[model samples]
Target: MPDLYSRRSFIAGVITAGMLSTATGYLLTRRTPVTLTLVTGGDATGGRSLLINLWNRFNPDVRLDVLTVNSSTRDQYDKFAGTRADIYNLDVIHIPRFAARGRIAPIDPPDGITLLAPVQRVSQVEEGSARLWAVPLNTDVGMLYRRITDKRATDAEPEIGRLVADRTQVRQLAAQLATEGSTTDEAFVINVLEQALAQDRTILDERGVVSTSLGQWQRALAPLAAALRDNRIVAVAGEEKTNAAFQERNLRYMRNWPVWFPAIDREERDKKPGTAAIRLGRLPIGVLGGQGLAVAEDTGYRDEAEAVIHFLTGMPAQKLLATYGFAPTASEAYNDPEVKAAMPHLEIVRSAVEDAHPRPMSAGYADFAQVFRQHTYDYLYRGVQLTDGFVEGMQGALR
Candidate 1:
């Protein structure tokens, strides 16, 4: 078996090389009569290969050409658009924006099978709105990965804001926070959103606007602000730097998405007799992170694209991906024996996804994210807590 680095390189190469490619799991064959493109982020779980192969075998004439790009990069969104791909595996955060721009067409997914609560909510034009824009391929639930020495017991469930300030629980006060500067620090906003939710704050009112009194808003933000001020969570330069820090042994707790799970699973699977292990646990709330399948607005193959969506989201495809450790949007994946074996902490992931919430839904989500992050940066760092102006700006963006 390839070591971690080689495996990652192979994942990067993906389906781009086509039939003759010698990449580990992904293989290709003669070009089909009608080939549809599936553009998505770097799926580290290697689940896509299983799904793609299954798809090609089952739907022989219509093959999927998988293109995996670094969606986390700030400028990559255009690349996905330029592809004019048939099937876009869209990040949940981008759904509203994509839908509003007419970049992706809204389609009702297959009915009967239940999706995770948050997954169903996020499939809409905006949360609480009826238009269905996408069908979840798989789901993501962010987790806190802690590198423990001496076989430290996993908390399983942690009160994040309290954990940030609790010296006894966090023996070392340093954490590589996802917060760098405000721009594109979606995770920073997500972290605070999770913190605010933990404090029982209703982030948005019935009409879906930032709805908190000045005092209530400040109180909702207090724990995270205090933790940052006290240096319990150290703001790193960027996601890359933060992720690099997660590999080091000095840090106790790290916050990240499930894409990094393969590394932890590899470590546990390949550990030497005397080596230590990293364990994951439930974060207070995971602002739902994952992609859903949407048909590109310009696709000529709408029926075929919709069929592909139904096929991938169907139980068999979902289960294949789940067995490889992609978080299953369908609740039943939790009961699959192979999936359980692949992900030892499936319950932790299950719980995180269960308690998760979507980020404020708006077609102008980028604008909303910017406004929220700007004020949130002020709140977390400068201690400015007025929120009246912040609320006004968010309402403006939402409109």
Candidate 2:
């Protein structure tokens, strides 16, 4: 009877030991649930959905909710400042101001991620500083995009002079898009500024103050003033109107960013992607445009929020953005096989980002942008003279 009891005890001991071992393994591998919310701009390229869906599918431990806001920056700042949102994806130009106002917190981007140098520089607290307020998610440069039929635009101009010698053709083609209602896509303020940049001149200096002399401003703006006076381009209120006009075939050329490529491609949905109807080329100069990811201070799940941010700016997300025609800020994305195949003008985009001029930084960047537009609006749209007062108005707004 004693031997039988010992055998039974031995069996019980083995069973208990097995259960404890299994429990220990489970405890070590188990993950705590984490939930985070992110705020971003409108997703015209449809990339936000792709990224969100991917994160939810793979990372069972983390749940990320994304919100898209279409309102102006001011309205958004007012509405979401104290909300439950943990991550903020804002324009690169506004990062400095966002950091200054404490709307978004400075971050340390995860290792193994590389951002475009110019883009990184713009998002810094100071030039060449080790500090960074945000991580650049994507980069942009205004390029001339137009639709073509039958033949490639390259073949059409075998000796294409690029923007240097061939811009005249682009202009002439835009002027001749239609006879009675001929118009080229032109968004106000941005058009004037980009054109000035294209001419190798800038009105606002690095400090966000007006720095151009009267003669320099006039020489740089002569083409636009003449175009407006001659009715060569329409002063559309914004990019939406400009793109709408372009889509309706009322424009042979338009001033647009890389983000609009997806919507424009959809217009020719029936055509093969390899022989797409649209052709894109770079301008001699480009105004840097893009968005960055920032964290909100005093947020719950700080670690999880930053983890999601790392994922968003990581290589996988960058590649997905490239597929949608949005310029990915990751320099490696430009070299990824899938990304290169997705965008035939990859070099054009890369060069643009590399050579693009960043907007002047100021704590009051919004006011500066408005002041610039207000001062240049009449001069650009009404063909009025760009006067000394125009410069003063811009200079005053920077302060």
Candidate 3:
């Protein structure tokens, strides 16, 4: 398997070679049909490849090229922004920012495209406007995964927020678990830093404008820092780390989507039998994120692209994608019995999608996102005051 550096180099070469060949004389001699490159982030590459294969069955003339970008959210944004790629497999939360940059073309509703209403509703650019910068592909919602045998797993199910609220209760539990030989290197894994800022209620103003204000973000980070400090939760950076801890029975609770559960199940089955049994619940009031597909602004075959997008989002394609363990972005798939059976978490994802909030929508919002990640870690893990650390970072980035 290719490592990160090699994959990046390969992707860069693919993009560069295509562009450079067109600039020179290679296009004239090349016998292959015109290729449409779709740049995407996230781990649905397998599902996307399947979708591309299905698309080729209809339009064999146009080849679809899939480029997998960075796995890290921040790195992925930088990679997408640095290159002038054709299509972006964007996270729904990131679409507003991409639109604000005018970096991509919008899918006009007047064109009579076959976009799913729920997909559109979740990613609507403006009310009654069909012009969308992106379309929903696979759903992903943040979920809280706790140990099945945790103290909170008594007769009554406890609300996750209430459990994480009181510092003493959390500390006492951690101490008891430690004394009882259940101590682990990492107690809890939470995406505290990322979710806090992006999921802030105050990030959006009354008129639906995105705010990157330091004060607003400072307030957001407070609860997160308190959780980490008092709850003894170790901050985790990515899905893999969170999954690893959960599978090892090291994590009492962690933030993740439905995708991680199955992978963890398999890993635990192979490594530790009992660890396979884990509990899932809704994200505590603030975690939301999902992925979507978008037509490249530069594709020559708009009509074909429209048809392909439509077909991929339709019932058949959604069912296939869901079978591969992806969250269906289409309502048809979300409502399907088979799809729901395959992914029981669809209900949770559905609620998250309907109530989901997009991240900051500024043209320079990617930059703002970076600041959110940086200052959040600084204040939450490094013991910097939420206000002082966050305010300085935001003022510098926004300026």
Candidate 4:
């Protein structure tokens, strides 16, 4: 039986090799069909499957092999640097670094391609001069999730001024809810990192300068400190934990991404009698997040790769992505009746995306982020004050 199993494996290997050889022969002879390799991040949404199906139907002669890389953006860029993949789905934050390193090719979008104005701005990364480094795929932005109640949430979108006012209101609301028999310890939740980024107070500026001054850091973190002292805001570890706490109804208001709306809605629907109400609203500005399609510089099938990118970012594909739970980057996708019905607060999301700020576009952004995270965490959770010494340390880390 062992010998038979080994013999079967050998036969299968030979058959596979023969099939590959025949395909290579056909490719060499025909010169018409193109097989493009795409390396991208994991598909939490069903967008990738929809894209492949649409591509197969629209361009029958083009064969696409997608390799999903579920890792950090730095790791994704490293893998692209070492591989021969024709296209990449890169995190937009890393576009400047990848473009600077020449790991990805600059894009020249086809005529008639319409990108949401804000998405287009973020997709173009400048090395020496401004160039379209990637085509916008789906987009994401930070948002405020809260329990619906008798009092309407702020009608105005979230902005720095609004957030500041909201902080005070949240404290007042916590006191009011406590008086009204609420026993929860937390009234609001926000990530220190999100607040800092939303207010354009990153460790570094776009020009690779250390831009987070002592005054700026203090100003940016003052609200967080106030909330922590007042026990009005629960500082969670990250977005996942925050979302989990909110889902358990331990929180009244939370700052999170738009992706969690569907799950929150489901929870709201399943509420019995006195469950915490859930609703979604816009953050005046959030940290911009989403992936972009980039072609590798050395790809042999540049034309075909570009075509795949075009199909992925096109209106139909964007609509499909919206249907699959991703925030679309095309304006038309937000306007689609089906998409609107599915994502009821899409306009709020659109406003947030438009006003969202990208993280500092430095090659050393990972380092910058690390420094900010460490310092911010210490201040928010570990009882460290934003002193002159702390500010000095952060400045050094940014450098």
TM-score of 3: 0.71
lDDT of 2 by residue, 1-399 (tens): 234234434533443344333323222111577666788778875666666665666566677788776656434454555456788887776677678787776677656667777777888766777557877778887777766655634534221113323434333223211111112211244455666665544564333334647777777777666665565564454566657666654355666787776557555544433434666767656677788888887677666667667777776667666666678786777776645544557667888778776666666655656666655666766667788877666666556
Model 4: colliding residue pairs: 158-284
Error of 4 at 281 (Å): 1.6
Model 3 bad stretches (over 4 Å)? 1-33, 42-45, 75-78, 81-85, 108-122, 149-156, 168-190, 193-220, 269-271, 388-399
For each candidate in the order shown, give its overall lDDT on alpha carbons: 0.66, 0.61, 0.52, 0.61
Per-candidate count of clashing residue pairs (backbone under 3 Å): 0, 0, 0, 1
lDDT of 4 by residue, 246-295 (tens): 65644556677777676565556566334434566665456677888898
Model 3: pairs clashing at backbone N, Cα or C within 3 Å? none
- Tens digits of per-residue lDDT for model 1, 317-385: 665565455777877767766455445577678888877877766667767777877898887888887
> Could you tell me how far off, in angstroms, the CA of residue 290 lies in candidate 3 after the best superposition?
2.5
TM-score of every candidate: 0.78, 0.78, 0.71, 0.74
- Which stretches of model 4 miss by more than 4 angstroms? 1-34, 57-60, 73-75, 125-131, 149-190, 197-210, 229-231, 271-277, 387-399
Single out the weakest 10-residue window by summed lDDT for candidate 3: 173-182
Best by lDDT: 1
Q: Give me candidate 1's TM-score against the actual structure.
A: 0.78
lDDT of 3: 0.52
RMSD of 4: 12.0
lDDT of 2 at 151: 62
Name the regions of candidate 1 deviating beyond 4 angstroms. Answer: 1-32, 57-60, 67-79, 110-112, 125-131, 147-157, 167-184, 204-209, 237-240, 268-277, 382-387
Error of 4 at 372 (Å): 1.1
Q: What C-alpha lDDT, on a 0 to 100 scale, does residue 165 get in candidate 1?
A: 57
TM-score of 4: 0.74
How close to the true structure is residue 308 of candidate 2, measured as C-alpha lDDT?
67
